[model samples]
Target chain A: MKRSLLPFFAGTATGLANGLFGAGGGLLAVFLLNRCGIDKKSSHATALALTLPLSLISAIILFCWGTTLPLGALCIAILCGLPGAWLGTILLKKISPALLSRMFGIVMIVSAVRMFLR
Target chain B: MNLIALGIAGFFSGICASMGIGGGFVLMLYLTLLAGTPQKEAQLFNLCFFLPIAAFSLWRHRKNGLLCTSPIKPALLGGIPAALAGSLLAAFLPNAQIAKLFAIFLAIIGIKTVFARRESEQSKEERVIRPTQKQ
Candidate 1:
């Protein structure tokens, strides 16, 4: 029963994190899922999967609240991101989880340090 | 919009999101620091930008059977409303305050990531495969 509820709890935290920060929810989800005994690769994929509906919901709420950017800017951002997303997916399949995990750590640390200092 | 900045932001954000690294923070920082976007607006843009890239990544992951369905329902159950509340909260906070909070959050997660231990590739793959076969 407690085990079953882990996903719900994980989701709640993820939604809050993502909605509040506009990013990092997936990382939180992956961390939580990993603790819940999900494998690293699956945790990563699960985090990605969950981010979809969660982000859509958040986007809808932001839209309803009139908090989003203009249409033109939104379009340009998404279009530009498409190629990166495609390339990322290919890389995801090719990369090993251990290496990805290390990279994720480095990215989080470096970015965090930069943000903190600035 | 600075087309070049937008392009770079979008590209990196897409890659990070697809890889489940939560690239939104990076995009947010880039927009705020480099593109001179207001923090509040940058946060909003990150969410919107995340939508398409995340969707695309989800599709690819699902098609490849990388996604595990077991946690989906419960995660949604908890995540959806919390996200809504978080967005509402973000609206009331000051921009600088939000940035500070974001920085702190990033630092914590970063530390956790750095400390996490990973097994060898072969062992990791076996573990993933073993669990899937059981399910």
Candidate 2:
């Protein structure tokens, strides 16, 4: 198996984000997928599928470390999010890529800015 | 590097996951962009790595106060079979269209999460119907 330099850094970035901050790791995954030449759909689908479990693992470690969270809200959002993700996928079928990209760029910049500013 | 990567990934996976977000994106980025694994391989690795990690983590959280299991039954009743049905159909779909759609979806979530600022609303929305509401 050939190893490359970039993905290692990508993993480190995500791991650090998870261990310390606990946010934006999913977005980081998509950024990697898009940047690395993976088709967008696979990136998203795979990202969604992949995150489900990773989040579970992350939660476990944090609990052991004695972190606190408000579970009720997350469950509602996730319960809503599953259907929402599916619904969003349907709507995406009719949307334009250019529009998506413009919005995506704005969101990415905004999210990063929030993290940086905070 | 592998040890470091795995260690870091495990740490991040727990923290990000408890927040109700996926850490896959971060892991994928690490595998694909940082480690230089191809996109496909990175994605596969993510799913494989995810199942056990997530299940175990959820189990741990359920024991603590961070995770709950009471609501899973109703949701799974409808979700489980549908996921299977959808997966079977997704098998024959086209790639280009899928990629475009994925991009669009991400952009919207990115926008929503980025622009929304009211944490109060988020907190209120998460509270379940009180036991009294069941009647």
Candidate 3:
């Protein structure tokens, strides 16, 4: 791929995944941004910056398409998440991302198995 | 799950999300597998839940000088239309099928995450100039 086109292509894939799954776009963004030669910290931050608009667009489309959003749950989550976000930023320096990633990966695998069996 | 449980899950998921570590996945899993939310609905919920958090995070990152604007324009150009197309495709798919596909995606990501090395362990040489710096 041409160097200039990398971000565009990365964005395409990230947007598609976010729209399709309603999640996971940031993961794709971070990975692709890193591949684009960005530093890890910037990759994470830049991925968020990139995905924010994509997610907004996706959410709007999903809403217009008549997906019944759990508004109450959404509100609760956001309300509680604000402080949690702060805590997470603090923990980011203290915690080992490698360990957290492994643990999170395990949870994802278990959840996938459960979903498959259901 | 009860409201309290949901709130607790939200709190923890928020922490992970802000950390840029796929907290949305954690919330989605909890909603679908534990809280009995439908796959599509859970996805929608996740999207909505993430918006505000992402905005806030972006603000902080910008203040901290972690943001790079050079890639954002091209990325958004490709992302906006693609997001619309993907949403349409998702909307047309049946719930069960979406669930199956989501499971597969989760599995793939899980495997990748498990095998991936920590960024801190990477050599300093991999850190390149910010795209903006090249301008």
- Residue runs of model 3 more than 4 Å from their true location after superposition: A93-96, B120-135
lDDT for each residue of candidate 3 in B1-135, tens digit (9 for 90 to 100): 578888988898888777777878878888888899987888889988988888877777677777878999999999999999988888899989888888888888788878776676554434554454667
Candidate 1 CA-lDDT value: 0.79
The DockQ values of the predictions, listed in order, are 0.67, 0.04, 0.69
Could you give the fnat of all candidates in order?
A: 0.77, 0.03, 0.73
Residue A38 alpha-carbon offset, candidate 3, angstroms: 1.2
Candidate 3, DockQ score (0 to 1): 0.69
- Ten residues in a row with the worst lDDT in model 1 chain B? B114-123
Q: Which pairs clash inside model 1?
A: A12-B78
Best by DockQ: 3
Over the stretch A19-89, how does candidate 2's per-residue lDDT look in tens digits?
22233445554444333434343343333333443334444444443333334423332343333333334
TM-score of each: 0.87, 0.43, 0.90
Residues B1-135, model 1: lDDT tens digits? 788888888888888778776677668767877777776788778888887788888889887778889888888988889988887787777777777788888878878877766646536777789888778
- CAPRI grade, predicted model 1: medium
Q: Which is the better candidate, 2 or 3, if ranked by TM-score?
A: 3
Model 1 lDDT at residue B65: 75
All candidates in order of DockQ, best leading: 3, 1, 2
Which candidate model has the greater TM-score, 1 or 3? Answer: 3
Pick by DockQ: 1 or 3, better one:
3
